[model samples]
Target: MQELQQHLEATEQRLDAFLVKLTQRAQELLNGFEQEAVNIRRNDTIYGQAYSRFLAATRGQVQKLREKVKEVEETQIMPVFYRHCTQSSLAGFSSMVYEWRNRCQAKILQWEEQLYASESAAIERAEWQDYETVFQSHLQQYHAEKEKVYCKQCGAKLAINQVYYYTVYITCTFCQTQNIFNPGTSARQLEDTARKLAEQRSRPVLEQQQFYQQRERDLYMQAHELQLSLIHEKNNQIIKEKQQAIARLEEQRQEAVVKAPQLMEEYHRSVFDELNNLLPDLREHHEKFYRAITTHYQ
Candidate 1:
């Protein structure tokens, strides 16, 4: 396993290095093309008139190199992806093919556009027409103008040279199963397949998210229940404390009521003793009158 991992890592590094090299090469090719176009506009040299040819050649070489890189990566990746990885890697294969297909299509379009932009010049009208005719011929020759396809399963080659049913299907002539080389497919079929694949890629992630969400909800519910139980216990403790306080206050009130009659009788006796002391002081101030009044009252 370690060795395989190391090999894969090394391969990835090499692939990355190659991609950098390819990018640099592509930039250089584009710069060369722009320079050639400038030279053509300036009428720099006899060869400058043929600058479009050089540009086309450079683009074609770049495209071939790109295809070579794709082939290398696919050859390395496909077998491992199928044998070692899970179902998810199937989408990776589709992506790899899509990239390669788009790269090829872009290159073809670039060359076609370049050819359309550049035209050969001549001195006279007839000469110009002849030049145009020859230029178109060469353009067709250099481009080959045929979309070539091959069967992935059986290695059968198909070329689009003319308007025919062959150009539409371009399938494997040997096996009519549409298993490998169906370059031309119906628009509806393509759309449906793309939609289905998009759904498939999302389905796994969606299910995983739902599972996590359900787990979170269950944990929250359990925590909430525990919180509610703790709160109920605290409330019960508060109720018990209130009951104890009320009971103590009631007992104190009962003791106060029991002592009330004795306290009132003592207060009345103290008041009578105070009045008797005051009467002796009054008799000392007025003795004769006090004696007369006392005898009369008696």
Candidate 2:
């Protein structure tokens, strides 16, 4: 049992170290992107003439990193996450590594806006706000230029003004399934929104990213707190769970009383399901919306 404890601790450290390595790589990638962003923002240079290509490349980089994060979650995490550990360590998987995933995502969203603004001409013109807003056109012009915002799941046209700048999760009346939206996105991205939604349109996604990040942190925190109680106050229960998990593994290996497997595949599935259950559905639904908005102009 003591050996098992030591092994679990070592596995936890390995998982933690692995997450740090992934983050380091992501940071390195973004550092190169930051330098390119600086170059793109400078309209006086020849590089600025190719801002469109740079922008596409940067977006591609972000997408590539996002996919990598998903791959790690699907592959690397199972080894440690499924093993017998203190409940605290089990919960740590979500708060620690999954939190890193979300933090990177938030950073990417902020950088996306920053990169866009660097070339917006709006940044050079800004004296009033750090966040850029649509300012040049009027509302009537907005209506003429854009299609009505509609529920992607259903064909119902959505009311756009209420959530024009930031993404919102809305339950569609027709489909009764949650849908994500950045309402009036086409108008919001326009240089102006008839001055009515101008302020809303100019609002930076960085501010909105905070809300998403906090929501994720809150879920992990809650799960971590509960797991900590199991570690400290419910140690017996934790031991029983671990023993049962091991016994199942022993049976799977055709061992009655011998040393069992270090981890159960079932435990991994449960931990993964639990960690993802924390916020996966929300993100999955939002992704469809995210794709819609990101590809709107394309």
Regions of candidate 1 where Cα sits further than 4 Å from its true position: 1-3, 44-51, 86-298
Question: Model 1 — which ten-residue stretch has the worst lDDT?
Answer: 119-128
For residues 220-284, could you state the per-residue lDDT of candidate 2 as single tens digits?
Answer: 44443444334334468776775565455434434311211112222223333332333243344
Q: List, residue by residue over 147-202, the lDDT tens digit for candidate 1.
A: 44565567666544332212244556676535332323332232223333333334
All candidates: TM-score: 0.27, 0.36
Highest TM-score against the true fold, candidate:
2
Flag regions of model 2 displaced more than 4 Å.
41-49, 79-216, 231-298
Supply the global lDDT for candidate 1. 0.44
- Candidate 2 minimal-lDDT segment of 10 residues: 256-265
